[model samples]
Target: MIRLGHGYDIHRLDSRENAGQPIVIAGVRFDGSPGHAPDFELGCVAHSDGDVIYHSVVDAILGALTMPDIGCLFPDNDPRLRGADSSIFMEEAYKRMVARDYRIGNCDVTLICQKPKVNVENDAGESVKQLMRENLSRLLHTPIECLNVKARTHEKVDSVGECRAIECHVVLTLERTA
Candidate 1:
């Protein structure tokens, strides 16, 4: 059997955490500096690390399994979850996916942001999209070849395009291994 899931998440980049607070996407940090830096003067207004990539992936995994989403399983109201690392949420989702006997056949992610382009390499000489693919593949135990990440801009038409927010959309196919 095959199952398909789709997930989307968006978060504001201001009015909460100040800029230069570190904008973590997928698992990489784009921080420091001011106008010269990517995601300059922007920070996600979220209780967790505000990694839209991971959050969307988790939601996709849960949706494919017909289970509760990230919000339900990890409520934002919980004080313990404040400043939580999003990878923990992703690991739990992966565990659930495995428990249900499903493995990723293909995972595609589209990251929308006006700043801090996802195509550029970080200070560590790692390409953002490749790093994200690697991270997701590692977390889900799927071959890196099975995953693809694409970067996009909102065309200066919305909040994401304005650099006030970041958004991500994920679609994945789960195939039964047994």
Candidate 2:
């Protein structure tokens, strides 16, 4: 059996936290400057690392299994979860998938943000996308060929387009292994 699931997530970009600290997305860091330069000035504000891409992927897997969402499984109010790694969420979702005898067939992700262009043209954009793909492949235990990552701007229409927030959408295909 093959099942398709969709996931979406968005987080506000805090202008305050952009000071030198790097914001993690898909386990990769995006900072305003290299080496945590104090001049760095843009990052997402959230309880976790605020990696919308990873969060969306986890949601996709949980949706595929008809399980609770990430917020339910890992509440923001939990102190222990403060600044937690998003990969942990992905791992839990993957475990659930395996328990159900399901494996990932493919996954495609679209990230929307105006400030950080995710193309190779930008210094850090393309590399970050590739890091995400590699990390996701490892997390899902799937071949790199089965995963896809794309980034875009919202054309200045909404929060993401305005560079005030970051959003991600994910589509996951799961196949029954047994």
Candidate 3:
């Protein structure tokens, strides 16, 4: 059997003063770019680590399996889940997928943000994307070639474009392994 699912998530960017924690996306922390003005100090605001990419991928897997979403499984109100790592959410979804005899066939994700360019000049951007692909493939137990990631700026149109938020969209294809 085969199934397809799509998921989307967004979080508002917070100033360092307002955000009690650092920004984490796709399990990678945003440690401020040295090239940015006086060091980059932007981050997402959320109850958890605010990894929009990871969360979206989890939702996609759950959607493919016709299961409850992250919110349903880990409510924001739950104190135990406060500051929880997003990878835990992904692992939980993976357990469900394995139990259902399903494995990821392919995954494509897009990130929408303005300020933090996906890749700066030189090999920095490419390196980041490669690292992300490797990590995501390992997390999903899928071949690196089966994962695709793209980033785009919102062109200063909305919150994302204005550098006030980050958003991610994921599409997943799952195939039964049994």
- List the global CA lDDT of all models: 0.83, 0.80, 0.82
What tens-digit string does per-residue lDDT give for candidate 2 at 49-148? Answer: 8879889999998898888988999998999978778888889988999999999999999888886665442243346567678889999999999999
Task: Give the per-residue lDDT of model 1 (tens digit) for 1-178.
Answer: 9999998999888743574257788876666333222444467878888899999999998999999889999999999988898999989998888889988889999889987777876555556677777778788888998988888888998788888889999999999979
Q: Could you estimate the TM-score for every candidate?
A: 0.91, 0.88, 0.91
How far does residue 177 in candidate 2 sit from its true spot (Å)?
1.0
Per model, state how many residue pairs clash. 0, 1, 1
Residue 125: error of model 1 in Å? 2.9
Best by lDDT: 1
Q: What is the full ranking by lDDT, best candidate first?
A: 1, 3, 2
| Candidate 1 vs candidate 2, lDDT winner | 1
